[model samples]
Target: MPEKNVPTSPPTCPTDLSLIDSTYPVGVPLTATYRLGFAFKTINLRLPVILTKIIDQLSRDKNEIGESCGQEARDDVKIVVGALAKFKNEMVTNKPIYKTGCKIWDSYLEHIAQLYFEGVVEDVKWYFAPWLHVECYFYKRIHDAFQLSNHLKSFDPFRKQKEDGFECSKKSSAQLAEYVLSSDSSDAVLQTLLEVGLWGNRCDLSLSSGEEVSQLGNLVDQLQGLRNFVLCDESANFWKILKDAKTANPDNPLTVGYVLDNAGFELFTDFCLADKLMDRVDRIDFYVKTTPWFISDALKTDFDWLIERMCSGDCSDFPVLVKLAERWKGYVLSKRWTVVESEFWTYPHAYFEMQDADPELYSTLTKHTHLIFKGDLNYRKLIGDVSWKPDTPFKDALRGFCPAPLLSLRTLKADCIAGLRAGLAEEIESKSQDWLVSGEYGIMQHAQ
Candidate 1:
């Protein structure tokens, strides 16, 4: 969304992913080795553009950033901007990744060296490394830029883009708010809202590399047409899981956990679903990133900012929006909703690594009756970002990471996928070349 202010036009990744004759064997980590692959485009083009936008924002907002932080704001902005500019060059030239030397990153670097570099991290370059490790490292390095500054240690370069994205979706958000608040809790109604939230994943800015995107028109009314685009649906299974949990627990209150994804409209839809979910669960724990991530990923600050904006902003025309916002505000105030920040969420490891890497967080997650993970990046992480066979069962792809019954509401923005019917991926690929990474398709897959 930074108005072509970067040095070059952003390069586009191909949406198509050929089903058979894969360049890598099944279960291999995805990398940019496939020249036409999304990872290739992302590393070469999209990532640099994202960095350029940050540099532009910092340069443009120096005074304002200075005013908010301290007298050192301008100098802090310049420092981060220069760092980011250098980082962008590193990415574009496919330079070897270096240690930020931050305690957390250094520890994770050891892990990465073991997995991909065989203890020699100097061998890990930007392009050929596992897409997940390098992409995550990309953001971590960006955070390190600000982290080194005296006044900008806590700055978030993508905050305004996330807020602007929400503003763009306000009308559609009000519509969904009214619809959900007024609807009954029937299974059919819940299914509709679930689909709405699933489609909301399409609005992710990180997929667009910081470009603006949002929901449009009445969200619910468009669902009938969007149905076929859902590659797999387990909404009925999701509802049954909730029902069974409540029934089996009887005297106990069911607790749900949300491993949230992007901010803006997708996050707004997440709140709408959570509002409905409260009827079946006693408490909902919302997991958030401890720092800025993947450009648009939810942070505790993003969550708080949304709620404040909803409550205090002019919503007189959509009274129900504010009404629901107030209820959500109270949920946090009264402890019905809890926001959790953990370094584990930002670590450059797959979900399967959780048990050994962060057992305490894994154990805490085990206490939940169900966990809902949102968006494409979480889906990629859940499956280890491996190139599995098209028809691989979702549970099998999980590599034993199940801490509780979980559902992933994801729109396909990456080439990797699991839990498709035999021949389904081939069938879809035959019809549309862009079927894999277009964000035009989605899945609501559940696993225990």
Candidate 2:
């Protein structure tokens, strides 16, 4: 078991959300006029366009796919293409989520059935469902389309974009890699690395409508410019947790775990940080998305692909990257670094719901010194995607979901937030009309 170094921060301002009131920015019934509404609409509509592009490319290059998987993959390609088009059309037309016998089908269906049993007439409608449920079902439905196919059960439509996104950020990766190795005080370097890890979140494909945005200019120098933008700064607390882990395990290095977010560039940045963490910890356990979820989320395959890319790809000009790649191979060989996949992550449920929904996963979470949740969706899950008043305490919103002392490193790409000081959210809103979705601001909150 990991030694506890939990912070003792009181709830910022305890605000109860259990009371029911159907209205926008306060409580239930998130409507079409809000940014959440528009963001969901844009993502749902944009995915089909992406799926078609993948299908077309696959159809044109069936021979290429066959060279690796087998000729039967051509038929699987056709199955996947047809299924993706059908799924896209269903969402575009507001068709009810269909049953596909997935593991979550019973729970999801029962939720809607119960909603209908109660008097919620718009029980299963896409826009009418809980924003979290709607979003969760959308990605699962996409995965189902591929899963029901023959040879393409594991095929990832978003794989190309993820790979391309990483390729595009090579310059940023190299700069951060070099900076990490530069001789500097341990505290300053750790602080810089944490901020770089935070900013790496700005490039999420889900927020950018499937586009790639690389980190720009000198990452270390850019930290001061981003300082004021971080609504909640807990980088120091996180470092303390890491240091405490080292203290606890004086004879052996502690293990750190990451509930990973986006793949490609963001994951490369995570690796840059993980590479540093490895020097102190016995290992780092990366919990990746079980499937190609939310488009650019890291899958087990993505982790494997990145290792291969670093080891064999022609981008050999980066000495830091190459050195890390070689070190990563040895770490893998020595069984010091490990990867895990859990369907619970890809499930539509919130973090608070995890202990009940998947106790096995929640039980596994307890082994880590700390679990670091990356990116916006995980943040949304942490807070249950509730419309809590801007100053609601982070732990208060957590609703007792803390499995271990944890940290959330997220850029504010969505409206749901908690743990800000009084008036901070309003102040941010007054200064910038769209602070939440602009990716200009961030949060590095810690909770015990």
Among all candidates shown, the one with the greatest TM-score: 1
lDDT of each: 0.85, 0.74
Number of residue pairs clashing in candidate 1, backbone atoms closer than 3 angstroms, sequence gap of 3 or more or interchain: 0
What is the TM-score of candidate 1?
Answer: 0.94
Best by lDDT: 1
Mark the regions of model 1 whose C-alpha exceeds 4 Å error after superposition: 1-24
What's model 1's lDDT at 361? Answer: 98
Give the lDDT of residue 37 in candidate 1: 70
The C-alpha local distance difference test score for the whole of candidate 2 amounts to 0.74
Estimate the lDDT of model 1.
0.85
How far residue 64's Cα lies from its native spot in candidate 2, in Å, is 4.1
Superposition error at 414 for model 2 (Å): 1.5
